[model samples]
Target: MGSIHHLIGDLPHRSLHDLSRRYGPVMLLKFGQVPFIIVSSPEAAKDIMKTHDSIFAMRPQSEIMKIITKRGQGLVFAPYDDQWRQLRKICIRELLCAKRVQSFCAIREEEAARLVKSISSDQAHLVNLSKKLADYATDAAIRIITGTRFENQE
Candidate 1:
């Protein structure tokens, strides 16, 4: 039952787009027991996100998320409640404030420069850009967290 049949063979986004064209900017579709309100237009999205954010702020709970987040304890998966608000405030003040982020700018820039230099140095061969970028990210995160760079991946 539901609109799951409409999405049988096509990609979800393509199917949604086709349905939106037929239905209009805002359409409701049900996938099994869950009902989803699909907003295809920018205006509708702004209305939902900006004008009515609190009404739609809560995310659906899942067994996997509960296990990963220790029963919705962290900021990312926690319910929209007092604990989540306090966690958000503390994170903003202590970790993600403008000054705190700016303090790590030098480390990020240095890592980026190192990544570019590494790529340039290996111009003769097929450089694995994905792995290099992942390494750069790990190095930068480690440096920022511990204030020391790893020596030979130690």
Candidate 2:
């Protein structure tokens, strides 16, 4: 069993970097008995992501993710297999086709304009571009996915 509570209490990214510095690039961590391999170095990440893509293509689904994603039915969280391949093909052929993507150009441009307007309006002090960009991206994605803008978002 791993100290998940402790991990949650600490700054996860910073803690991971500290661990990676103490250990090597590839460090095996146990999160509540589930082993997680952390690859810190770019060369190691490239090896896994590019060279042996098929071997580690599937994402590790947590219990909460499984529940939220309805047993991993969507393309983003689905397991690597024939079913996943078929789902990916459908997404590429239908949802992500050139015409379909082009249809959302207006939406993207509108969101960009909104972001620029918000930034320009907040010219009194140092504007937090990171937070603004995050909000913009979230709103844009929600609108694109649900066909409705997020209401009362600050």
Candidate 3:
């Protein structure tokens, strides 16, 4: 009986998709200790995004995210106030501007060169190309974001 209750209490994740199809687009799910509200349709998606943008803009203050981001600086966890607006403006006008965007081209070229070198260095066996490519992508993004190559650092 306890096992049955536990199983039943689990969130509908992929399994719940079918049940939501039978019932409706929006549904509540509880997977053990976590809770989730699933939105499964295009119309439901637009309604939440457009009509209730500000209503759902706030994030649930999670402890892990707090430790990682130092409790949300700009857009992600900001209260949509003046400071958030100013930071957003700077990101759009300065950080993401045309000149700043061009700075990433060099980083991309370097990361790509490293990836190609890795692939060519050992091609005698059945290599897991997928894993290699994933590593390449992660390294490329990290390098671009932080201006530091993570591959050589660790």
lDDT (C-alpha, whole model) for all candidates: 0.90, 0.87, 0.76
Candidate 2 lDDT over 1-154, as tens digits, reads 6845535755888788878888889988888888888999999999888999998888888889999999899888889999999998999999899999999998889999999998999899899999889988888888999999886445
lDDT of 3 by residue, 1-154 (tens): 2112433545735556666777699876666566766788999989999998977777777888888767787576776668778888988998799988897888878878988898898889777889888888899888877878775553
- Could you tell me how far off, in angstroms, the CA of residue 34 lies in candidate 2 after the best superposition? 4.4
Query: Among these predicted structures, which one has the highest TM-score?
Result: 2
Alpha-carbon deviation at 62 in model 2, angstroms: 2.9
Q: In candidate 3, which residue pairs clash?
A: 11-31
Question: Judged by TM-score relative to the true structure, which candidate is superior, 2 or 3?
Answer: 2
| Full candidate order by lDDT, most accurate first | 1, 2, 3
Q: Candidate 2, residue 40: CA error in Å?
A: 6.0
Candidate no. 1 TM-score: 0.71
Model 1 stretches with alpha carbons more than 4 Å out: 8-15, 30-36, 102-106, 126-131, 146-154
TM-score attained by model 2: 0.72
Per-candidate clashes come to 0, 0, 1
Report how far residue 51 has shifted in candidate 2, in Å: 3.9
Q: TM-score for all predictions? A: 0.71, 0.72, 0.69
